[model samples]
Target: MPRETDDHDDPTRRTYLRYGAALAGAGLFAGCAGEADPVPEQTETPRTDEPGTTTETTSSGQAREACLFPVGCREFTDPPDSVTTYNMGWADMVVALGHADRLRTNRLTAPTLFYDRFDIDYEAGYPALWQDGGFSKEVFYELDSDLFLLDPNLLEAWDDNWDESDTAEIESTVAPFFGCYNRRIRGEWQLDLGYPEQAPTMLESFDAVGTVFDERARTDAWLELHADLQARIDDRLPADPDPPSIALINGGSAPGDGEFYVLSLADDGYEMKPYRDLGLVDADGFAGIETGQYGLTDYETMLEVDPDLILVHWGITTGSVTFGGDGAFDATQFREQFVDPMASHDVGSQLTAVAEDRVLPGPTAEQGPLVNAFQTELTARLFYPDEFGVLDLDAPLDVPESEQLFDRERVRDILAGDL
Candidate 1:
């Protein structure tokens, strides 16, 4: 049945895009309860129930169930027949748990990422594969998967009324869907949510995947590693007086303007719940943008802010190439040609983020796990190196002169800027 437009899930884009002024929390838009949840799309054929195995805990008080996934840890007594996995998030989580080979079929990102990851780029590989811009249904169905861990919002690609609709009546065999709380609302993914960076989120996802995989030990280990990283970041925060205020800028092709589309911390400060997971985005400190979508601006507005540091995280989904069209960090021609000139504009130039060279894009081709962890740390390190440690992002992108950016003391010195 088609969904009613007025349903809670189908909030109008015009109104929804306004974002209702988020309050502080773990994530920006409540990531729809659990990440494993999927909006019922087409389901797979059902199989007879089979005997399920139980997980055994390790000697260190960690169970096979919790070891793999650390956040939403649960003992999935009965593994679903032919997982009809839905989103890219879990695909990545599963791989990290050392069980990706068992995946039935995934609906979120594509397989090209799988090949790329197993072969070349590990950073951008996972996210690129799942949310990878180039997903082909022919290839998707060809995998013949069973359980579906999906993001309900992706239904917009098939049915317009999807947010309010239900596909359960169709007799398709599928598992319950998981989703990031905020992802339930359409277009919410575009906002930064200043939610904890990707690392902890992945850990949380690991917890969720652990419940299904029953790898408590692995999940616990991952959690320990996650905590260690957080501690490392926390202990390292710059002690110098006058902590710098940071801003994130995105490169865009729209309006041919020089400024990047900006993203703001949720509820103003950085210390939100999700920030706790990633140790960034304190809501009490700074205010975020309200409009949420890409907008053109001149150099003057940037100077007005007098940003202590400026960081670049560019992506133009608003272009003609999005929405079933081919578009992603790789497909865009901006990196080689427009990257420098775009940053060198009025606002791009005056800021210390630009002059001292503190910009970093948010993609790593092969390190799927690291890509998930990039956001909070990438930006945090740029503004407070003494605290966050020196960050090296260029090498992963294989940018020419990438080594220049890798320098411990002065990264921007050797990097190229062509604008």
Candidate 2:
């Protein structure tokens, strides 16, 4: 069952706060260029220990602490007035919590098309934390968010200039970091930087966010909805499932160049949750292809493997949003760029997946509860058109109300706090 609430007595929040306060009292706020402010002293109250009940303190006092990977234990004095995120998944969670207005900054271009369906203009005048191909320390000070929904490990891994000291400085002076880079274990850098062996599921991560933001009700509703959808799909699935073998590749990959970056269908992360839930087989494993070096493959290797289906990762995002200066994904344009080249190539057209036109757009990895719901349905239709219906590539979410896996109005109500 989904975790509806956290009832355990978490003393870590008070302990961590006291530690920071002691450091602040010592005037050791490093890297703020002598303008660093000390961590504020938090007033706490006794918390109730009851099942299905949260341990949060009064609104005027320190909040109950929540724990997750990378950033272990953290507590907020109140629901964050403003937050900063480096990924769409975290941003979407804030939006789903009806705190879209609290988003102060984002790292990537927002997936506005998906947000538009929920009547959210996520990117309107939103500041980008990344500038000129890298992150600037000054930006963190400038944003001065109440909380940072970012993984500290990622900052250290992505840029050599950022390290534990930098993260500590910001935590002491600006805000606490409360995010995990559990999308997919990119490389050894993450492990070297103390990434845990196991991480929470997408829904679990969402629940933690809810706890921090004091939005447990919204998160609970989402979990219940997700559980219902899971049950529905489970009941409908074949008892003796012979799921299709698929080759998952990045959307930016150019097949004409004979180079493709194959992603794992069996990886342990929220990014691959939908695919794993569907029981889809990984073609890369069968082909003895190594995804270690970023899963680089060529047409000759692909022809040798001949997967049953070819799935373009982040295809849905490209189709819906104009990302990274690339125009929105158009079927004709995609064909011209990917499909047509494969059909014309001497080595590409012979593949079973290409011959059968099984090349389809896959969902994005940066998904929260809201995007995950729709993506799961979209993937189901794409995988089993006979059972679910033929998905229109141009407009993926155009499924009839009766045919949709979940009710749009119900989701809208949840987001609108009408639950």
Candidate 3:
């Protein structure tokens, strides 16, 4: 459960208002400091399983001037040396871009575990500012990072107490917030919550981050690797094959007992991008849960659709096995505490996925380009074991030479600037 905190603070309000007034009068910028055009609503369906196809790249140029969004734009003259990152997605982007050394603050409570999962080495005692502390404006001031690789919309989503004014204060006093909230599939609730601006796709957000860091060449290299991986996957896809119907679930974050937050694939959020890109049909989208994002569904709601497969998404929260639940991320704990319990539950046992043992853990929620590549491979194995090889859960995630989707050594070299 989240810590209960008062939404209103009279003294903080007074202080913020006074400081904001001064900054505005002095003509401080409130938006990003890089140039970007308005992100158009992605109405076109994702590319089919056709070889030699590429998605267009909208970001270019090396000199960071301004990043445009629906709200406005912010200009940047100097690259940031230190950055503050929120959650696994932002942290992963920094690591992927060879800027992990610049991460001043990180969200993963177990930094070593994250490093091990990604197979990256860092200082033995690398310090972290905080983890899952629920975004403090005071901490932002104290850390005083050169840039914040987070979306203002996300800050608001996490703590509705924050608004545009709060975001402005961070940009004016400390540094600009540069990324988009690329997680959720847009829903009606998002508009009601005051986040009407559509977030960028994972690739788009990464490109923006590359622009901010003046690493367009590295970004291009990564995109090339991604294209190659996609081409491989496409070559293996059977022509006009009917993919299985899937219901994505983050069982860890049940708002209450016996309920789960069901993810909709309709809007193509970052977490579902790989699955959506592969043309897997979302069972929930077919069921028509359109008005809600991260909607809480009970056993009855789940049983109604009875998807062919159930994908359990990971990293919903740090340390805890279940969001707002007391547990950890160990294999024994996962099965004993989560999998076994759910498998035996009256409602859970009745589901088609459980009966066929089709309930499998999905990819990490905090995804980057490389992570997405891994996820795409994982999904292919899960859905089409006859076509792609079965995934070895106990073994290291290293793919065999013939089975490798992308060159790991080459990616490492690019990130290490040895390219």
Candidate 4:
């Protein structure tokens, strides 16, 4: 749980009030049952640095503001003492900025698998925001975080009870929401749900978070390290390299089940950053699968395309975690569960990747600067073992120090505020 704030000034009251008023005027909130509820008193007098200034100060204290799509401008007094996030990418960003201790709670549980490799003992003690297969607004109120690194549109899309008013009410009474939903492209049916059509890249998003938390120094350090690793990989690849065609799928996919959710390897979201950076070809394109469809295919379909490689997404994190509902990623277990089944099946056994043992574990979609750095290197090794060195999927962190693409000790130092 997050540490409770002593100050009840509610600095964001003015902003949310304006937002709510606009929505009410547009009839967006008309006939709402909670419309009669009185707005909280404005204890903090607002201060503008300049006319039409986005930055301002509340009577309670100095406040900083930053704008990210989906959730427009957000104002907060000082860096958040405690924050809540449903997405692991945002949570990892907070951790990279040396604020893991401030994380109140999050929905994902496998971050520790990556963090622990860098000696980051990140453990969230509170219950997940998601409960009984849906998000719990009561948990949000109970946590009482200073900020929510969550996209409001995601709530509207995932929770039947959540709406624009619910978000506005929380911002007015509690803390403002600041997040962008760029994990993956939502279905076309969900387009009108307020999802941002365009969003910053993963590193760009990290920079915005740095601004919000006043941690530019740490963010800059991580960015520099990221650039160094990317350059290393770029320098090694051939100018006209023929990248392998690959099929990316959920880590939990079982070939024996004959159903698999195929992900886009060339999507614009941060989840595909590593694959894009490596210039891996999307096998879906060859298979006549449309991007963003998130379509499921069977073993026979996989045989038709015959991707050069089959990468299990979230394989590293899901497999590394010692304790989780989805058991860890052990090589023997993975082979038994996924590989052997494919080798035995008539259609699966015929696939080139299956016969050649080109199937391998891949990275998680929810990655920040820290996780991205490691995953990029891991993927590089997985894809081109002859050049970058082999990666033991079961023991991903055990890469020989000489084979490492980035400095592990340096990253640990950066996370420790030694940068």
Residue range 156-188, candidate 1, lDDT tens digits: 333334332242311133234433332222233
- The predicted structure with the larger TM-score, 1 or 2, is 2
lDDT of 1: 0.36
Structure candidate 4, residue pairs in collision:
319-329
| Candidate 2, lDDT over the whole model | 0.66
Model 4 alpha-carbon miss at residue 238, Å? 1.5
Ranking by TM-score: 2, 4, 3, 1
State residue 263's C-alpha deviation in candidate 1, in Å: 1.2
**Worst 10-residue stretch by lDDT in candidate 3?**
3-12
> Which residue runs does candidate 4 get wrong by more than 4 Å?
1-62, 189-197, 284-287, 290-293, 322-329
lDDT of each: 0.36, 0.66, 0.57, 0.66
User: Mind giving the per-residue lDDT tens digits that candidate 2 earns over 172-239?
Assistant: 99988888776665446543432334344566667778878877678778877887777667777777
RMSD of every candidate to native, in Å, equals 12.4, 10.3, 7.4, 10.4
Across residues 81-125, which tens digit of lDDT does each residue of candidate 3 receive? 888876556666777788777777635433343345446754323
> Which has the greatest TM-score?
2
Q: Given candidate 2, what's the lDDT at residue 36?
A: 17
Task: Name the runs in model 3 displaced over 4 angstroms.
Answer: 1-63, 66-71, 109-119, 122-134, 156-160, 185-198, 253-257, 284-294, 315-330
For residues 233-258, write the lDDT of model 4, one tens digit per residue: 98887778766788877664668887
Provide the clash count, candidate 4: 1
Q: Estimate each model's TM-score.
A: 0.54, 0.82, 0.75, 0.81
